[model samples]
Target chain A: MFKKTILLKDTSFSPEDKTRDVFTRCLDYLREKQLEQDIQVVRVADSGVYGQGLVMKVLPDATLYVNLKDEDVTRVIDAAAQNKTIEGLALKKAPKQIRIVLRNCGKIDPESLEEYIATGGYVGLKKALLELTPDKVIEEMKKAGLRGRGGAGYPTWMKWKFARQVVADQKFVICNADEGDPGAYMDRSVLEGDPHSVIEGLIIAAYAVGASKGYFYIRAEYPLAVERIQKAIDQANAAGLLGKNILGSAFSLDLEIRLGAGAFVCGEETALIASIEGRRGTPRPRPPYPSVKGLWDKPTVINNVETLSNVSFILLKGSEQFASIGTEKSKGTKVFAVTGKVKNSGLVEVPMGITLREIVYDIGGGTISGKAVKAVQTGGPSGGVIPVDALDTQVDYENLQKLGSIMGSGGMIVMDEEDCMVDIAKFYLGFCVDESCGKCAPCRIGGYQMLEVLKRVANGQAKLEDMTVLRRISQAMQKASLCGLGQTAANPVLSTMKYFESEYKQHIENKKCPAGKCSALSNYAIIQEKCKRCSLCQKNCPVEAIPGSREDGFTIVQEKCIKCGRCLEVCKFKAVSKT
Target chain B: MDKLTPEAIDRIFKQNRQQSANWIKVGMSTCGIAAGADEVYATLVEEIKKRNIQVTVKKCGCLGMCHAEPLVEVCVDGMPTVIYGRVNKEIAVKILDKHVNSKALLNDYIFDLETK
Candidate 1:
């Protein structure tokens, strides 16, 4: 049995890996010293550290040694064998991630209510029901500074307080699980991983607002999440946690799941309420907000999956603990579904004040293609793009909003150099255009027109005046749209145009796509000097754009090429070039 | 199975706190299942039964490391609890054979995430 383990990784950018070489050398040295059985040496895919030549982490201790040389293998093995540390080589590592929302994600059996309870799961609800009054519960939320995580950062306590103060016989709480962001899955993960937590949070919210009924507005697309939440509700009902007289307190609430038909606009509060009410899922103006008039004309409190998840923890651990984490205004950790061009793409829960750089590099392990990250797209279509130069900006409600991006639903998509800004803006704008309910003309018509202009820009057919037209239309849509969906639909275009206007200028003036992504603006050609005259490009071109024999080197016919990139992909000698 | 009172919740919490000393938890959420954690989980259970290993195999949810799905966390008496990622049937067998039986940690498979 080995007493200690050493995880080794060749973190060098070189294509050639040195982990095997170093592993063998360490094994041989340990075997020669008759300590092979005492120390275990292993090669890892990622050592959690990057760009350093070679990294060796000794565990149980987790002392990382970076830029290790071949001779240092003996010293590492020796240190492990003797249970000592090499002061000069040892490196201290601070944890870059904190898990509050995902606290019991991998720890307990989610299917078993007993396991969740054992891990202090429903204890928050128990405390809320037994000790705290409705006002006290709202007070705790206010002290915790918890905010809604459904793209909008409204204070959770204020939403509950408004619903509580309203003189209504019937009030409701809805857990917004209708996550429709392109790359965000934080809600789905939480609901699937720990359904009870969200349920507990919902129950806590229901209790705080004096509501007897609650609903989970989940998208039908997330079958797994829906199934898990259904099971959780059933379990809670069985355990007397859901239906009538919950925890033997007078505050009894019934919770049910409502499936959304995969409409993006239905994620809005008013639209969600409309969907639940069997009405057409379209948004109306908010003044008498959902807290005052919502869901069958009754006061309702809508909290996001992430927001409710924080409620249970805050009630259980006290407001101080929850408030202590994150920036002053934004308390507790925010879970982000970090995806798109990232190396370690997954769900990361970080404190609110953590920098985007730390989240992208330290936690995400940088981009997947080993290319520098160009920008990060946050808040889905409603949010904006944050350029790489501003990566040091702290992440919070105000900070992201100040950076022209809302903290929408916590979808942080890391984009590398190959991703064209104009193309990305067009993709998000197109999503909003397709999802527009057509109730409001600004979102219905404005989104379509903006997308049309973006298409023209992408196709390299737009004039310099078109940029001004795009901005003018975006402002009009932002100001005239009746609902949040239409109001924020232009955010992606506005943000991309703000940060990447030069790329748009390149597309408009030079008729060139800097990222080589927009096929409409791309031109493909055969580099005559590099071509081997092997007929490979000619044989592979589906359009027969490359026409010539092996003797007479192939040339690309530009009009027939279609810019499919098949020739570029099939070319062996790097003969095909795209501009 | 009745409506839990505050006292009952406390009792259940206390009773559940005393977890078994040796167990293996497989992440079984959508992300984990998509990455074939169900197969890995089945293999671990069957292999443990076939070998009559004194270890318990259970299912849990994703640990936020969706990239390293099919994560298998092993916790045995006198062994440091560690999560092995990208696990499959073969690795499950190796885990039971080498790590569980001989008390040796697998080298490259352990994913040491800083979740503190």
Candidate 2:
């Protein structure tokens, strides 16, 4: 039998990689010692540790050694082979992520109800049904301290408790899977990967609030998730996990799937309830929140897919266990769809209070192009930007808000130096404008007007007074918009103007895009010193903007140039430059 | 077909949790499928069955590693569990032939996360 295995990776941010050569030498030394078979040396793609040279994990034993040298390999092998560990070389990396909601994701077969049950999946629902009353369940949730994983970190227990306290003949529970946030797909993955977990959570939630029915408000964009969830519901019904008398208990609940017609505003609970009730997917005033007067004029509990998934785990493992992991205010893990300019762009379920630097550098493997990360955009279009300097800030509800950004949804978009702050703001603002439901005057008109002002700034046509106009409109939208979409429409612009005001000023006053992202403000030309006078630029110019001959030395016509930078690609001597 | 009692549910849960000595799970989520996981899954089943390997081939959801799409995780009783990424038909077969059947590690595909 294989006794031990050593997985090696170079997690060094240092310029040189000495992993392979050093590993080979160590392998050779081990072979010379006739211990090649004793300790299996495997080179891994990632060791979940970054910027530490020559990372090696001795598995079965799991004695991690970092910053190794030529001499340290033999000692590592000897100790690892003997089932012993060296003290100094052992790496004790604090896990950047703490998974509760994603506990079954990639661990169990998503489609297999049996596999889910075996992993103690439905035990939470079982416990909630057999042991706890509705009040008791709410009490446990209150202890666990789980806020919604959806944009607003509202207390989960409060929503349930309020709905439970209300005397409604018919109550409902809705899983808000209408995840339309830019760069966020956490809900989709949870639904597709562990459909049972979310299902079980929803069932427990229904029982806790005395709801007879639950509806999954999933978006039409997620076809596969829809398919998986449908299969799961079918399996649950077949297995008598749903319908009348669930798991041989009187706490019976009926579940259905309601597909959202891909509306961004409908992700809001009020708008989602409106959509479910067959009304136009727009938000009304929220004094009578969903918990008070929801679908069909009855009390309703709307929870994000991730939040419900946590319910089961908290029940199965106990609320204290769940609450112990995260920060004081936010007491659970948050799943971030880490995308854009990051090396490891994926879903990362990190506990609250973990530093943003740890999430981006340790878990995400830093920026994709190896450039210094400029900022991280969390909560999508509705969220504000966090500059690189504040990366060490703990990622909790309050911390993110303190940085002038809300943890809108779990979309954490990494931005490098090449990503112009103004350009980034424009992109998000444009998305909000496009997705705005146009129901409220402030959101409808304010969003369009803000977009126009941003466009003017981007086109190098705006004066500095436009900044005040942007602030004024942002304040109006923030205070007056009906739903989250309209209210946070100005987030991107306001954030960029706050953090990178100089960049915005540069675009307005000097008519220059420092990152050369804004095409109207950018100038494209060939650097005469570096030009090799290659005719490839002239041949490849789409608009015939480069008008000079190879003999006369190629030059870009400033008037005719569309700033497409075609010459930049064709130049072999690195001649073409854009600024 | 029958209303599951609490005892029955417990029994079913117990019966389903099978302990496998060795296995390979491919992330078959939409993100994984879009990145050509279907082909990889089919190849692994075919190759493992053809080779008469004892390792159970299974489908799982996204492990949150979307950038490294088409992720294939291998766990042998003897060796460390590793997630090999960018897997195709060839790598599927290689995993079955080399990682499962042989002792040597496959070149440049192994990703070892701290499995707890």
Maximum-DockQ candidate: 2
TM-score of 1: 0.97
Per-model TM-score on C-alpha atoms: 0.97, 0.97
State candidate 2's TM-score. Answer: 0.97
Residues A545-577 of candidate 1 have per-residue lDDT tens digits of: 888898888899988878889888988899888
For residues A1-579, write the lDDT of model 2, one tens digit per residue: 457778878878777877788679768877897787777777777777777788878877667898887678788888876788898778776666778878889888999888888888788888888888889999999999999989889999999999999998999999999999888999999999999999999999999899999999999999999999999999999988999888777888999999999988899888899899999988888889889999998999999999999999999999999999889999989999999999988898988999999989888889878899999999998999999999999989999988888887699999999899988988999898898888889988998898899889999999999999999999999999988788888888888888999999999999988887899988888888988777889999999988878788878888998878777876788888877
Which regions of candidate 2 are displaced past 4 Å? Answer: B14-18, B114-116
Cα lDDT of all candidates, in order?
0.89, 0.87
- Candidate number with greatest lDDT: 1
Worst 10 residues of 2 chain A by lDDT: A88-97
Stretches of candidate 1 exceeding 4 Å from the true structure: none
Judge the docking of candidate 1 as incorrect, acceptable, medium or high.
Answer: medium
